[model samples]
Target: MQKKQSEWKWQWTKVYDDSKWLFTEWIYPNKLKDFKGKTVLDCGCGCGQHLNFVAPYCKQVTGIDLNTPRIAKKNTRQHKNVKVVEGDIAKIRLKKKFDIVYSIGVLHHTDNPSKSFNNIKKMVKKKGKLIVWVYSYEGNFLNRTAVEFLKKHILLRLNKNFLWVISNITAALMYIPIYTIYLLPLRFLPFYQYFQNWRKLGFKRNNQNVFDKLNAPQTFFIKKSTVKKWFNPKEFAKVHISHYKGVSWRGSGVLK
Candidate 1:
C-alpha cells in the first residue's frame, strides 16, 4: 500500500501540468447543478483537477489524497473556497460530513477499495449525496489479464525512463487505430465508447493516459454486484449504478 502511494505520487509529479477536467463531465454529467451551494468533498483528488470544476459552484470544497496533497493544494490554490488535506480514504475520518462526496478513478487503485468505499461513505451526511467511479470487472477482461500481466511483470519492473519511452510509443501507435478504425460503424469493437472519449483528448493527455495505465502499481476492477452491495438500500434514499462506457462502473446515491 505504501508502494502504491509512492508510485502514484511520482506519477502525478510527472503530469501535473494537465489542466483538463478529464472525467468530471462523464462521471457527473447531470449532477453539476446539485453542487451549487453544496459542501463537497473529493476523495483521492489528484492535483485538484476536479476541484477546479466543482469549486466555482460549490459553497466550499475539501480535497483529500493519500499521496498528492501538496500538489493538489498548489493546483487548487486559486480557489479561495478549496482546502487540500493529506489522508487515505480507507482510514481518514474527518470531523464533518459533506453535502456531496466523490471519488473518481481512484478507489480501484487502492489496496482495499471496498474498505475505502465504506469508509468514505461515512463522510456523507444524511440526506447528502455520494458518487464514485471505478473500473468494472465485468467488461475489463483484457485489463485483468493481458494488461495486468504486462504491468506487473514487465512495465513496472522497467526503469522510469524506459517505461516513459514505451508509453510514448504506445500512445503514438494507438492514435492510428483511434482515428481510423475507431471512427467506423463497428460498435462491436472493444472499449468503443472509451476509445471515442479518448479521441477528444490531445496528444499530451493521451500520452499521460497511457503512462498512467502502464505505471500504476496495482488496479482492482470492481464487480457490478459488489458496487450494488456498497450502497445499502435502507441507508440510501435512492441509488443508481451503471456500467460506464463499457469499461467502468459509475454509481451515486442520496443518503437517507
Candidate 2:
C-alpha cells in the first residue's frame, strides 16, 4: 500500500504551513477566479495547505484522503468551514457534488488516474470545473534523468529510519542553487531555473515518510495528448497544461 495510507499521514502531517507558490502557481490562478462562492473539493488534500488557501473562498470545502491520522492531524489546523474526512480521494461517496473538484500533484500517484479523475468528474455539478497539476516530463535530458533516478531507485530503496534522513539531505541540497543565485546575481547560471522551484520537490521530500510513499507504481507518467483526450470525452473542455506540458500533460479543464 502507498505509505500515504497510514505511515505517511502519521509521519508527515504538518507540512503545509509554507509552499504557497505550489498551490497558487499550479492550480489556483487558473481556476480560482471563479471560486469566490463556489463549492470546491480538494482530492488528496495532503497537509491541507492548498485546502487552507481555497477554504475561505468557497461556500464549504471538503478534503478527503485515505489516511485517518492525517485527517485528524489537519483538525489541528482548526480551519473553520473546511471538513476533513478520512477516505480515498479516488473512491469517495459524497451527498453533495461540487462546483469545482480538483487534485494537485495527486492523480499521478493513483493506481489508475483515469478512473480516479473520472470519479472526480462525477462529483462536479454540470458546468463545474476540474483542475490538476501533475509531474512534468518537460525539460532537459539531464534533469529528467536525475528525477527518474531518484523516483525509481533512491526512493524505493529507502528504509524508514533513513527515509527521513534522505529527505532532509536532499531537501537541503536543493536549496543550494537558490542560495547561490541569491548571494550572486548572474545573468546566466547553470541549474538556476532548474533549482528555482526545486523547493517544490524538496518540500515533498521534507515532509514525513514521503520518500517511501512517492514510490507508487503509477507515478511514472502520461502524455499530454492522452490526458487531454481522456477528459475531452467526459465534457471537460481542455484548459491548459502546466507541469507536464511539452513532454507530458498535466492539465486543467472545465466540464461542459
Candidate 3:
C-alpha cells in the first residue's frame, strides 16, 4: 500500500496544480490565528504543500505520508523546520500527540474512514483540533452529478489521458456561466483561471488517484450529519463546517 501510495503521489504531482488556492489558501482554519506556536500533525500529507500553509504559524509542523523517502527527504530539506515522515496513517508509532491533527481528502479513500479517524484520535491531544475533508453526498447537486457522470461513464471506460482532456474541456466551459453570474462581462472573463490549476491545465495526474484507473474502486460520500455523529460533544466539540467547493468534498470540519 505504501509503495502504491508513493506512486500515487508521483502521479498526482504530475497533474496536480501546485499554485492553486486549494493548497495555499484554505477555506477556514478554525480560529486560524490559534495555529501560531501550536503543534500540528498533517495526515496523508502529499509532497508537502499543506504543511507550508500552516508552517509559519505553528511551532512545529509534522507531515506523514506513504510517499518515497527521497521525496520526503527533499520536502524536509526544502523547509528548514518542516518534518516529513513516511508511514501509513492507519498504523504509526509516535511518542507525542499534537494540538492539531488534520487529514484532508484522505479518509474517504480508505476502506474504513471511521477507523482512520479513530487512529488519528490516538495521536491528538485532549481538547485538540481535528480537521478533515471528505467527499459529501448532499453538498452540491450540479458538481456531484457532473462528477458521477464523468467517473461512471466517461472516466471508467476511457484511459486517464483521454479522461483528462474531457474533464478539462468540461471544466473550462464551466467558467462561462460562473463568470456570467459574477456579473463579469462574459467576453472579458478569463477562462484561464479555470485551467490555471496546473493539473487540468497541464493535463496531468501522473500517479495520484491511480485507483481511479485500476477499477474505479468503491468510493463513499457522507452527509454533514453523519460526520457530526462520529464525535460526542463531551469529548469532541463539533466545529462549524467550512464552506468549500472542490473537485470533491472540500472543507468539512475542524473538530475539537
Candidate 4:
C-alpha cells in the first residue's frame, strides 16, 4: 500500500510544475471571482496548481495533501498568501475554518472518497461554500468501462517509470482521434460534446491530461445522485450539481 501511494505521489510530482489551471472560470465560474478577502482551503491541492491560480484573489489559501513532501511545499513556497501542510483528508484537523473549501479532481482519488468528503466538510465555516469535482460514471459508459478495466487490470500493476512511458504512449495515440476531430467540423457539432474541453486545451495540455488519467493509481467514478447525497440538507443549502460532457461532476453548496 505504501509503495502504491509512493507511485501515485511520484506520478503527480512529475507533472506538478506542468500543471495548469486549464479551466478555473469554466469550473468555478462566479464562485472564484467572489472569493476576495476570503480564506480558501484547497483539499488535496496537487502541486498547488489551483492555489497558484486563486491565491492572488484570496486573503489566505491553505493547501493540504498527503503528497505534500512531493509537491505541496515546493510548489507553494514562493506564494506568500499560500501555506502548504502535509495531512490526510480523512484525518487532518485544524482549528481554523475556511470561507471556501474545495477539492477539484482530488477526493475521488482517495481510498475512501465519502469519508474524505465528510472530513473536508468540517473545515468549511457555516455559510461558507464547499465545491468539488469528480469523475462521473454516467455518459460515455463504454469508454469509461474500458478505462476502468485497464486501470484495475493493467495500469495498477505497472511501476511509476513504466506507467510514465505508457502514459506518454497513450497520449500520443490520443492525438490520432483528437486531430481527426480537429480536421473535421465535429468540434462545431453539438453532438460531439466529449472532446469539447480537450479542444480548448490544444495538444500539450490535453496530453498532460491524458497522462494524469492513465498514470494515477486510484480513480473512482461517482454518479450525480450519489454526489448530491454526500452533502446533507441540514448542513448544506442551495446545492447545485452540474455535469460536464457526461464525464465529470461539479457540485457546490453553501454550508448551513
Give the top-scoring candidate (lDDT): 1
For model 4, the run of ten residues with the poorest summed lDDT? 17-26
- Tell me the lDDT of candidate 2: 0.63
User: If ranked by lDDT, best first, what sequence of candidates would result?
Assistant: 1, 4, 2, 3
What are the lDDT scores of the predictions, listed in order?
Answer: 0.86, 0.63, 0.60, 0.76
Q: Write one digit per residue (lDDT tens) for candidate 4, span 1-256.
A: 1122665577566765333444463355445577799999988887777888778889999988886544766776778999988788877899899999988888878888888899999999999999888888776475467877887788878877787777777877866776685558765443256675666665566666777776677777788788889766877888878887657788888999
List model 1 lDDT by residue over 1-256, tens digit each: 4343567777777785343455565465446778899999999998788888889889999998988899898888999999998888888989999999999888998888999999999999999999999899987888899989999989988888888899999999998988999899898888888897788778888898789889888899999999998887988867888887798888888999
**Per-residue lDDT value at 106 in model 1:** 89
Model 3, residue 234: distance off in Å is: 2.6
TM-score of each: 0.94, 0.75, 0.70, 0.88
Supply the TM-score for candidate 1: 0.94
- Residue-pair clashes per candidate, as listed? 0, 1, 6, 0
Model 4 residue 1 CA deviation in Å: 11
